[model samples]
Target chain A: MNEERELAINPIVQTSVQHNTQVVSNIRNLTASLFGVAAGTLGLESYPGFIFYLIGTFIVSGLVFVFRAEGKPSEYFHRPLGDLWGGDVFSGLSSFVLTWTLFYGLVRA
Target chain B: MFSSPDRRLQIADSQIRRFTDSQIISMRHKNEANIIPSVYSTHEHTTTTPNSPLPLDITLELLASILLLSTGIVLTSQPLKPIQWSRWSGKMSREGRHGTGRWTREGEEVLSEGDPYAFLGLDGGGEGRRGFFDVRGKRREYAEWVKGEPGSK
Candidate 1:
């Protein structure tokens, strides 16, 4: 059982946690802002703007998982679904809303 | 009350400091150690002040543009470019590690192969194709950090 457990564990390849986090955060902040811009440009109202951000974030998360993690969540992320998909999911919302509101104001103005 | 030598020494030190007056009124002092940017800090210079300029002179539209541009870049950027994967993922025995290996990614095929060990971005073991380093060096760098290498950097 002990040997089996060891075998079940992953290999000794390198994974940069800090770099991964940085990449993720950058993605969140930058994209969230963009989402805000799009929503604003589209003149989306408060609730609609927020909803837009949520949907935008899901798209981004999906892309990050499929591309960055290569659909092997366990290999790249410790928490699998949580780490790859859900964690930091909401981070970009602020940026999205900010931009969305700004654009809405800009366009409406 | 009698003063001990240690007490006298402390008094003398303070007296000297006072006499210099120059020391207290010295030129503007800047804390070099405090200048490093903190990851968590919002970087606003003052929290007490209301309606102040942000740390980066950031405006609403500017902030928005930055975010959208970033998302676009991330989307357009090559897939799996940041990650490094070896052919062997299962339990790698000590001996098996040294054996020849190849680069692999999940979504793509037909390109990765024959990356030399000395430069494959392992624990400084990758030769980097004549001591060169790739953008994917983070994984190897991280591995080295995990091993607690003394100044492997």
Candidate 2:
């Protein structure tokens, strides 16, 4: 297959890939919770709160791209689009909602 | 564990600002409660009424804290290694066990684990190869060491 040939020519290190993925997910999860706190403090409700999360993720992605990936994502991630941008975007949702509700109650109360 | 000093400072600064901002908000809330004594008595009515918008200072502090926290998190995240096999191995070898030239002490420590070729240093291997062995010199040194031993007498 064409994919097999491409892989043969340009081999990937499994360990390095796992490490990079773990690092990205860790950052996403931590920052997602932080965004929840900010959104709750700002008194955002429903749709606006989710939108705030998207924007926050975008900023974190940009920061990782520039600072962590050193402006060349291809070197660090096999599939930069999925791994760096889209990956784990939703994984942080649970934690985000948890903190969002908790802080929303505290700040609004 | 291997965070930069700048990242630590930023996190500390943001936390302090966040604490102060929360304190200010709580104080303002207490003052409001004192002014409108009846409002506190009717908790359900107070809950029903929509809260006022956050003050400019609190909003600014929230934004500042988010920026500082995100920056610190990004900087503190583990540095990614090259994913390509050739590049990854090349980096490992080039950096070596201690990461002599490029990496800092902490970075070297973090990265020195699981080196594929590290075992080459064991037993008469790599640097201890027979080709480069000084047999005469080693024998002489071993003889001197044996002679100097306390039990030898």
Candidate 3:
């Protein structure tokens, strides 16, 4: 397969990949929860709340792209779009929701 | 070396942010308890209304904090090594073991387990390998050195 040849030609370092992924995911999860606090503090509801999460994540991704990836995602990630942008978005959602609801109640109560 | 200061700054920033957040929340709670009685005043309602948008200052502060936090996290993360074998090996040989400064929390250098070929040169394998040694050539060189000495003449 073409994929096999491509991999053989330019082999990827598994440890480096895992380390980079772990760092990005850790940042995403921490920032997602922080975004939840901000949204809840601002009293955002329903659609606006979710939209805020999206925007926050986009900003985080942009920061990672610019500073972390050094404007070249392809060098760091195997699939730049999937790994850097979309990867672990869902994984952070649970923590986001947890902090979102907790702060929403605390702020509004 | 450079990351230590940056990480300290990040920690300070987060601590300050947490303090500010708690202060703001506590102040809001205090205001709510004292300002609003059973009468349900319009002024209290205007400020405490769930539908009302947050002040511009608070919104700006939140966005700024997010930006700062993201930058800190990105900068503090470990630098990624090249994935290609050739590049990786070049980097390893260039930086050597201590040049990378990848130390553990206990201040020990992280051993690179990825390079299996590292052992090839560790024991002088290339220069001293069996069957490659020229014993006769060494003996000839030693005799020539002795004959050229002043004591031999």
Candidate 4:
């Protein structure tokens, strides 16, 4: 109680930005690759290929919030909750596309 | 056939038989040593790490070939990094910016390399109390961590 009072930091909404950022980026990259693999296997075309990844990323974000984060966005994320969950939506698109195209070519051929 | 030395002749014949048996046994050991080396040499090949691009399909399909080629570059290439470096306490003695430069610990802070007390966060100024950059004793900490590697913090 005294330590919290001395620093004047919010105990409820306290988390490290660096740690969250690393986690978010790591999740995005891995899911992007996985989404790409999925897209390729499903034989999804141009727009749908991209859409699949977007949806998958959202699902991953939800999983992170519910299971990994234990439904505590404010505690796990230093930035705005929306920013943490929604900000890096498109960050993994390139990797997803790379894998997606590769898979599609492989499966279709 | 000479009866007086018949025992000596029989002994000589036994000695010859023993010598032949020893020779045959020695030859067999030499052959085994040569054969064993060849058998082991075939299995002494180096093993490769099996992170092959195409693990799903065994057949050489067109899609698999194309995808393998396409992903080979992307998979091997290093991920993109927006910032090359975070620049924590970097020496900026380039051009005309001698002695004075900026150092970043928690955030950016203007610093003179020679100002030991102020640079190292031991200054008795009001900024010390406020912890403007919050880089208290970072210089010494960095110095200790670096082990004199010149700007490792």
Best by lDDT: 2
Candidate 3 per-residue lDDT, tens place, B16-50, comes to 45544445434323323322221122223334665
DockQ values of all predictions: 0.06, 0.50, 0.36, 0.03
True contacts kept of each: 0.09, 0.80, 0.50, 0.00
Better of 1 and 2 by lDDT: 2
Which tens-of-lDDT digit does each residue in B1-153 have in candidate 1? 223446534543443344333432221121111111110122222333324433332233233333333434455443332232433322222223242333346643343323335244564444534545465677888887888777665
Interface RMSD values for the candidates, listed in order?
10.5, 5.1, 5.6, 14.6
Please report, as a residue range, the 10-residue window in candidate 2 chain A with the lowest summed lDDT.
A100-109
lDDT of 4 at B33: 35
Q: Which of the numbered candidates is closest to the native, going by highest TM-score?
A: 3
Q: Native contact fraction of candidate 3?
A: 0.50
Candidates' TM-scores? 0.42, 0.65, 0.67, 0.38
Docking quality level of the chain pair in candidate 3: acceptable
* Tens-digit lDDT track of model 4 for B74-134: 2322222111111111222222134334557876665433322344445456545443554
Worst 10 residues of 3 chain A by lDDT: A35-44
Off by over 4 Å in 1: A1-15, B1-72, B75-153
RMSD of each: 24.7, 13.3, 11.3, 25.8
Tell me which of candidates 3 and 4 scores higher on TM-score: 3
Candidate 4: deviation at residue A44, Å?
0.2
For all candidates in order, the CA lDDT equals 0.49, 0.72, 0.66, 0.48
